[model samples]
Target: MSSKALEQFLDENIEDLKSRGLYNEIDIVEGANGPTIQIGGRELINLSSNNYLGLATNNTLKQVANEAVASHGVGAGAVRTINGTLDLHKELERKIAAFKGTEAAISYQSGFNCNMAAISAVMDRNDAILSDELNHASIIDGCRLSKAKIIRVNHSDMDDLRKKAKEAVESGQYNKVMVITDGVFSMDGDIAKLPEIVEIAEEFDLITYVDDAHGSGVLGNGAGTVKHFGLQDKVDFQIGTLSKAIGVVGGYVAGKKNLIDWLKVASRPFLFSTAVTPADAAASAKAIDMLMESNELVQLLWENADYLKAGLKDKGFDIGNSETPITPVIIGDEQLTQKFSKRLFESGVYAKSIVFPTVPRGTGRVRNMPTAAHTKEMLDQAIATYEKIGKEMGMI
Candidate 1:
């Protein structure tokens, strides 16, 4: 029989979440996660995917993925430290390094793994990490794993960061100090103040790390946030994901040559975990090549985002300040947010509600992602659906 105590714990917590409207129910996409998706035999104008450039369904990427599978079989077969490092992996890393304007780079199985591996590799118990309170969950876990003195810095508050940085260094309580933040916060869609962050890091001699998971392929002509700010050489570690804009599965750290060398030797995930599939590596490289070749997709993405934002605002719906394409339709109440999302789905839109504890309790929202693949007609329909739902619910 199952352990009664463990079963009780699971049952109680789940029930509490469900009653509070804090539990998230996931929806399955029937086919390609492109501009639109099919669920429950209905097509939805998808506004909840991280596939910013829509490269996930690109014909060229699909072709490359198939070719890689035919040439290299499926899996990488071993951890990167062993025999798993294929020629495709090398080519992908080389492409990433060049794309990010870094001296070298190293790839991991996912963006989460990149943080889990890289953070603990360079930092330890005696060090301290000043992390933005609003950083992704992966970054939080990675910093925790390092056993560092985790100092919470206010979200994009330069003064708070500087004060914390000063205290951390002057106290002489740690061997080394690092300041970490997301390049673009996914929840509210605001860009981080990187120039100020870099300035403070320089003053304190703190190591800098930016997880640009949401910013890549959507900024800096598709290079990333570091390049967007022209601080490519100033940042110590630039973290990115292949699954999002690159439209594949993997993550990487691009930095100085020595840092990449150290991570390749020291990062536990690279040493213990099998590399991403050969197809993933090849397809990712091909996507990067496409981004470097053209700015068409990036421009299209912004245009769609602007149109959606304007439509929502005109309907009197509150879309919080978003400097990037990741838009949040702030609904204020958890139940209301979920209801709003449900109404959207029924109207053939597929945006999802984000509630506590992913975001603060009272700031629940339905996050919208406008992709490059969406045509003007698709966006217009989505906007009209939003307006209808807002009027029905008295939210506008």
Candidate 2:
């Protein structure tokens, strides 16, 4: 038998969660996650993936990935500090630097790992970080790992950021101060007030960091949020993911040459973790090259997002104040949100319901991700299904 104490603890906690209607049941996707997917043998109009540019299923990416696998085999042979650093890794970093308009760049195993590696690498107990209250979980964990004094700034509130930054600096309680935020908040699809944040950072000489995981391929003509505000030369750290818009599997930090060089030597993950597969590096480089060549896919993504947002709003759904492609249909109650998601699944839509503690309690919502791969007909069908269910459930 398994450890009885461990089993009892899990059973009690799981039962408590179930009684409170907060238990989550995971579903398995049966096929490739494209504009549509199959789960439990039912095809669904998929709106849950982060494949914003639909590059995850792109033929060109697949071709290049296969070619890379054929040439380099399946994996990097060792940790980066050892012999795992291949020419493909160098090429991908070069492409990332050029795409982000940075002097240099470093790739990580994943976006979450980028944060985990980057933050603690620079910060320590003597440092203090002023972080946005609604920052991603990775950012939160990274801050905690640094053992820095963390001060929470109100979401997108410049005044709060300014006040906190002034206090953190003037207190002289720390050797260094940094401010970090997400370029595009994943939950509400709201854009960060980057220009103001930069101004504050400049005033206080605080290190600036922006995790533009969602904004990288969707904003600033696919460059990212820092570039969107024309501040590429200003921000100290520009973090992004290859998995989302790039349609591959990894993360990167685009910054000055010195910063990139330091991360290569100082970051624990980069030092100890094996590099990304040769296929992933090659495919991601190809994706960035494609994005740099044209704006067609980005345009199509925004068009689809506008169509879906307009459709949901016209139907009287509480689709929050989103500034990007992530559309959240607020349902308020937790159990109702889960039930609504199930109803949507039954009706052939695959948008997932997000609730506490992922979001604030009572603001439960179903997030819809409209990718460039989705056609008007598919979006229309999803809209119609949402309307049917919304009316039937008295939510509209």
Candidate 3:
């Protein structure tokens, strides 16, 4: 039998969450998350994946990944500090630094791990972090782990950030002040104002951290937001994910040589955790090379985004103010949002419902991620389904 204390705690807490309609039911996908996915043998238009460039299932990447596995082994045998720092891992880091236009780059097992590793490595109890109000959960957890005093700046409010930065600098209480924000706000798909942010950071001499997880393969001609705004040299730390657009399983921090050097030794996860697998590292490197080779995929992505956004707006659905390819159909009520998503799945679209904790309570939305792999026909069908279900449910 399960431990009585743990069983009772889980039973009571789970019951409360279920009653409050806050319990999340996980869905199982049978296969690869591509433009279309098979759920229980039913193929549906998949708009829920972060496979932005569709490189996750690209043939070229698969070829290289298979080759890497053949040459090396399936796994990196031990922790990076011990023996897992394979040649593929070092090459990936070099490619990442070149891609980000930074002096050096260090890789981690995952983007979440990168945050937890990088943040705590540079920050401690006496330091402070000025984070965006809507920064990702990983960023929040990373800051918490650092034991730094976290100050939430208003989301994209330049004035508020300025005020807080000024206050933090003048107070003279904290050892160091770091302003961190997502390069692209994932939920709203809004681009971070890096130019204005850099100006503020420069005025106060605060360390700048930009988590470019969403922006890596979407913005700045697929370089990132800092490059998009021509602030790469100014921003101190730029973080990116291999999973999102790179189509692999890792994350990296690109910065000055010294910072990357420090993180290599000081970051807990990098030192203790095993490095990414040979196949994963090789695939990520190939993806980066392709991104740098041409803007063909990026162009296709934006064009597809425009087509979907226009179709949704024409059908009288609110797609929200999104500067990137992430299209969100705002559905205010949580119950209605869930119902809407269920109906979409039934109608053969796989857009997921994002409610509170992900977004503000009343700002629930069904986010559609249109990839370069999606055909115009698929997007049109998705839009038509939205219109049909929306009108049927009186949501339009």
Candidate 4:
């Protein structure tokens, strides 16, 4: 293509994004994403990270990573199926399988890649996938890549799921049927009705896939959503991320040994992309070990979430129906929501606005992620900032 044509295309896309107020201007963080982060030389109370158990900066994990780096160097050098399957990678997979109560597990470069790999590996154009409407974008992409007929069921609406699943199976047009959902919807912080989903899947013989990216470190006393609901054996795929609660980097799918074996040979990312670093793998193993050792961090995280949610609710902010630590202070208009976030940042709070297409338009809001590392005083400060900005912007 000509340079002018390419430039025109880029300009038009940028203009479209600007027109929709969905263009995200990157903000550089000068320090680690802790309870307080330094951005633009200003310290802000950070509430937009997925570090639920606060392990991202934990000293123990840091030490583990350092040790692994010293021993194995930084990069894996090749793909896992190539010469990249380090002992650290195997160890991390073993640890993850144990943590998730699965026979085996397979790691990928990212949680997003896990979805991209697993979904397409199992389903295809001859299959049909019943996905929750509010599932993560990665899941949507995965389904699309699978070439499967995508059926979007209402979020947590079992009736719609059941109807769709039954119709798809009864038609006999599909060779396989799968149901995919986010264990905890990141946008709403609502837990998936896994028990109901499992029951439905069993009745219809539908394959179950749960992307527990948000629930892995925050739920099941850190065992994850499958264990939380006692559906470990029932769920076919338990997808999780090391970058979230684990405070490292990478993603994995925990399931039957045969499923993992198939993925090792079939998943495109595993076959074509390089493996995760030894340091990240080692640190993630250590993080899982910590979560299994005690509930102190998980409990503390819940307490912090409760405290922040209660304070926001008391202040008359429409803190949406969040059963987990992920909370959203709902503000309708996109521009107003962005302004609200900007004002919060100015006041030393780091909550970010969620707008289309990360979320539906007109449901724009600031999403808060309270971690175990946050003190009550810190939450109080955030609450005070919210109150001030909320009233000033007429959001409350």
Separately for all candidates shown, the number of backbone clashes (residues 3 or more apart, or on different chains) is 0, 0, 0, 0
> Can you give the TM-score per candidate against the true fold?
0.99, 0.99, 0.98, 0.98
Could you give candidate 4's per-residue lDDT for residues 1-396 as a string of tens digits?
A: 569988999999999988877888889989788999999899989999998888999999999999999999999999998799999999999999999999999999999999999999999999999999999999999999999999999999999999999999999999999999999999999999999999999999999999999999889998888899999999999999999999999999999999999999999999999999999999999999999899899999999999999999999999889999999999888988888898998899999999999999899989999999999999999999999987887767
lDDT string for model 1 (1-396, tens) is 999999999999999999999988878889899999999889999999999999999999999999999999999999988799999999999999999999999999999999999999999999999999999999999999999999999999999999999999999999999999999999999999999999999999999999999999999998989999999999999999999999998999999999999999999999999999999999999999989889899999999999989988888888999999998999989999999999999989999999999998899999999999999899899989999999899987
What value does the lDDT take at residue 281 in candidate 4? 96
lDDT (Cα atoms) of all candidates against the true structure: 0.95, 0.96, 0.93, 0.94
Most accurate candidate by lDDT: 2
Off by over 4 Å in 2: none
| Reference-based TM-score, model 1 | 0.99
* Pairs of colliding residues, candidate 2: none
Worst 10 residues of 3 by lDDT: 17-26
> Which wins on lDDT, candidate 3 or candidate 4?
4
List the candidates ranked by lDDT, beginning with the highest: 2, 1, 4, 3
Candidates 1 and 2 compared by lDDT, better number: 2
TM-score of 4: 0.98
Candidate 1 has its poorest 10 consecutive residues by lDDT at: 22-31
